[model samples]
Target: MEFDYVIIGAGSAGCVLANRLSADPSLNVGLIEFGGSDQSIFIKMPTALSIPMNMDRFNWGFESVEEPGLNGRRMDCPRGKVLGGSSSINGMVYVRGHACDFEEWREAGASGWGYADVLPYFKKAESWMSGEDTYRGGSGPVKVNNGNNMKLNPLYEAFIKAGNEAGYPITGDYNGFQQEGFGPMHMTVDGGVRASTAKAYLDPVKHRTNLTIMTDMMAEKVILENGVARGIELTSKDGKSETIKVRKEVILAAGSIGSPTLLQRSGVGDAASLSAAGVEPVLDLPGVGQNLQDHLEVYFQYKCKEPLTLNSRLGLVSKGMIGTQWMLFKSGLGATNHFESCGFIRSRKGLKWPDVQYHFLPAAMRYDGRAAFEGHGYQVHVGPNKPSSRGSVSITSPKAAQKPRIQFNYLTTDQDVEDWRNVIRLTREILNQPALDRYRGDEIQPGLSITSDEQIDQWVRENVESAYHPSCTCKMGDRDDTLAVVDSNCSVRGLQNLRVVDSSIFPTIPNGNLNAPTIMVAEKAADHILGKGLLSPIDAPYWIDEDWENRQRPREPKNAMM
Candidate 1:
């Protein structure tokens, strides 16, 4: 197979790249994924986000080697193997983090990727259901909505009020408003159905003559000649090995774990490591698998004394009614994305950026797909939005694409442990608020026994899990950066016509969710590759600005919200 653009891993970024690049009818684009079709009914249902977490058919169920910092427990890191990638299985919370997050990227070597520079691309990729305004884009493929129609619990309301009481302002929109306060989460849903990247971008262009989507094909290696990426070698479903040629460029959108591993296998990584793995070195890019970062959350679950949570409706009759409702109007419980409300907030006073995020669930989340919960329980998941600890992912073998070396040095530093402690303390405070008093129940995880920083640290070590956003493996930076794999324009440093368009290229992890930002990266990268215009600055969202009062001007609600 030959293509003008051979994009690996049709995940969030890959889907967007395929759509934008193939928009030109003359360019042939090949988008490949290692998982099967996204035809499962569970995937279309919003609550089914967890249904595929353990599903090997559509999930690349990879685990990290036992982390000494995390009490020697290996974490299960799920990357979407399907057409939509992690976007399909994620909780669907739409967040771009603080403006300062990108500024840190600019300072770290990714020129033109600061908060002001990436703002327009954010606007360009999003069709804000809330409206077309300064804070949002009206004409984009991906749908963004505040999900205000969904009812929020009184305890949840108190959480926001608690934030206000704690001195954080009420941010009406996390994406539009500042990320420093507490508020309801905005989601990528259309009429309550999950609007994934495949749903937003790929589906519309899948039938285009210039586009080719290949699923169930595991990309094993990139074919490099004279320090340039020519094509890729992959294994088909039947275990047949084959090679695909590229005429112009080979784009690696294989994600944080896959991208770095594939690079090492293709001989474009750390010289000593590649040599140890029995592969000849092509480019001595030391940072290909270094600087790995991910967000970890500790969920506090409690059995609600009142029988009003989603667990109360788990019976057969309620299930039948939900099915009937979905059949009648494509709405109701069946159409709901698991996360109803969440917020980004600072854990301490005087922090420049938000350090914690919350995922307020209507029902208790059972980590293992088959595990059973006690009763109707509500959960508040507290996760550190950004952490200082860094890890790495490396290739262990040259042939088998099944295994990779993933070392998540979680809680490696005292700063990381302290940040998590503050996050836990804040979560406790919110749960103890007056609004949460009505839903009051004893803590099921840490309980009252956990108070000291060391106690919480031990609890977190036992309970913390991945929030599923992994990035910064093949970081984008200046050529002078010895650890840089891609340039600011997403081009691989030493390889010609090879670019990495995925979360792996994020020089620094954003303060919030990574999906929206990843899509924004592709939106900007497309124009960069086409040489359509000079890269421009992206303004921070109006909410995050210091001058929030002036930017919150009135607008046409219908159009702006739409």
Candidate 2:
């Protein structure tokens, strides 16, 4: 098969790129996914997002090889294998990340990636469920919905009070003006179903003449000739290997794990590592699979003393009511994505932006439990906004089907340990706040007696796990930096007609969830590739004021620009 643009992996970024590039009906675009379709019933349910955590069919249930720094215990790392990729399985929290995150990317040699430059792309890709206004877009494939019919978890509100008591102001919407404070989470849902990238971008365009989407097709390696990427050698579902040529470009949107693995397999990685893996090095890029980062999180679980949790409504009556509600009005608990609320807060007073993020769940969740337990319980998931620890991923073999060696050196640095310690403490403080006093219970994870920083650090090393936001493997930087694998445009340093359009190209992980930023990258790259218009931002409408809350949406162009 031959195409104008070949995209590997039907992930968040891949789906967006496919939709944008294939908009021109003349261009032939090919998108490949190693897994099956997103036809699973549970995947479409808003609240069942976590059901994929230990499920093997839709997830690459990769685990670290016991990190010595993390008490020699391996932690589960789940990457979505189906269409839409991780966005299909992730908790549907809509986050654009902190504005400073992109500014930092620009400072680190990624020239055109400052917050101002990326903001327009963010707006271009969003269809705000909250409403169309200055900060939102009205005509985009991806849907962003605020508050579902489910009642707000009280614990989430209490976190806001706690933060205020600690002197932080309430940030109405994290994706809006401020990124500090606790509030109800905005989810990527359309009506009552999951608004995944596949549902929003790929599914709607499946019948398009220019796009060809293949599922269960594994890409083994990029077919490089001399120093340019020409095509890819891949094995189909029946084990038939063939080369698919690309006339224009080969884009690797295969995510953090898949991108690095495919690059190394194609002889575009660190020369020393590729040689050891029985592959000849083509680019000798040392940073191909280095600089791995993830948000480490620990869950503070408690058994509720009252009937406020999901357990209280797990019976037949509630189930029937939820079903009827969804069927009738597209509302109720059935539409809820379990992560009802979240917060961004600093562990102490000195931080510029919040260093810790919280996920409030109204249920007691155990790892891989056989049966669900319901009660009036609330969970505080403490995640480090930015950890200084870094790790790497490498291909263990030349085979396409084999899983790569993912080494997440969690809690490996002093800064990481301190951040985790402070987050855990801050979580406890929020849980013990006056608003949650009636619902609060004994500390079960680390227990209340472990007050010392050393004890807290030890607890973190034993319990903290990945939030699955890996990046910087094929870091984007300037040609001057020898460690740089990809340039600002995401093209490999020494390879022509080859580019990476995924989280793997991030020079560093953004300050919040990565999905939105990954999509923004594709949106911007699409304009750059299509030669649609001037790369500069079209001046913001004078009526679309900086105060987005009170501003009216600018009138849309009749046919919309790509």
Candidate 3:
């Protein structure tokens, strides 16, 4: 088959590209997905997120190489193998990261990627439930609903109240004028169903006749001829192989791990590494699989004094009731992911923006819902937003079916260690506040005995797990950057008609969840691919504490409370 664009991986970015690029009606666009259809009931039910995340059928279940810094333990890195990619299996939180994150991207040679330049794309992708504003989008594809603060369990209120009592400012919307504070989290959930990129971008446009979505098709390699990408070699589930030619471009939207591995397999990566893996090198880009980064979080669990947590509802009867409610009316406990309230804060003074992020869950359970506490309990999922430690994703063999070697090298730097210490310290302080005094119980995960920096560091090393936000394996930067795989326009360096539009193109990891930002990247890239002029940069003001360099909290009393 021949098409105008052949997008590998019908994930977050590919879905958007499919919708936008196929709008011309005459242009043919093919979106290939390695995973099967996202038609499972668990995928649509917001609270059933853990089902897809833990299922091998839906999750790639990639594990990192044993990290020297993380006490030599291998960390599980789950990426969505299904249609929406990680967005289909991620915690349904919607965060765009601090505006400063985009500014840093621009400063780091990612031209046209500053906060002012990227904000328009962010706004263009969202249909926020809170209505339209200079900062929030209202008429976009993705449906972003505000967490039901009033109807949420009391634990969410206590979490936010504790943040205020702890002297942190309370911003009504973290994605609005200010991001550094406690507030209701926005979720990519509309009417109690997940609003994945497939649902928002692809589903609406699938009937266009010009867009072809092929699921269960594994992309083996990019078909390149004389430094130009021409097509993709793919294998079907039934073991049939075929090459589909592309007339315009071949965009790699396979995500951080998948994209880098595909590039290496296609002989577009480091020559030495590719040669060692028995693949002849077509291009010698050293950065194809370097600069890997992710967020590592430890759940700070606390037994609840009151029985108001989700722990009380883990029984079979409760599960049945919740499922029945959702299946019938799309309400009850199954309606939300229960990460209703969350915050972003600085660990200490002198930071330009919030370096730490929080997702408060009213249950002491892991992401996969394993090892659940038997009684009422709660936990704060906290982690550093940006870690200085870097790693790489490299192919161990020439085969596309083999999982790539992923090494995040977690807690390898002093800043990363110090940030973990602070995250634990600040989280403990928040849990001990008067607002939570009614619900807070004994600490469960780290325990009260773990007080010293050394003990905290040990706990972090032993317990930290990927927040599932792996990114930057094929970073976008100026062509002058020695390690840059893609240019600022997301075009592959030293290659023609090939581009990468996914989280892997991030110049640096953002300050929050990656789903929203990945969608924004595809939106921006679509404009570039169509030869359209860039969106006019908006000068929307973001919240900044006047004394941020000197103090963690603002000096104004009004800023301290909602």
Candidate 3 lowest-lDDT run of ten: 553-562
RMSD score of candidate 2 (Å) = 7.4
The backbone clash count of each candidate, in order, is 17, 3, 0
Candidate 2: tens digits of C-alpha lDDT, residues 278-332: 8888888898999888887888876667666776665679767876776677667
| Candidate 3 error regions (>4 Å) | 555-562
Ranking by TM-score: 3, 1, 2
lDDT winner between candidates 2 and 3: 3
lDDT of 1 by residue, 152-172 (tens): 345456556655554456677
CA deviation > 4 Å runs, candidate 1: 368-373, 534-562
How many backbone overlaps does candidate 1 show? 17
Give per-residue CA lDDT, model 3, range 393-450, as digits (tens). 9999977788899999888899999988888877887778888888888889888888
- Model 2: runs farther than 4 Å from truth? 149-153, 314-329, 367-375, 534-562
RMSD of each: 5.3, 7.4, 2.2
lDDT score, residue 527, model 1?
Answer: 88
- Name the TM-score of candidate 1: 0.93
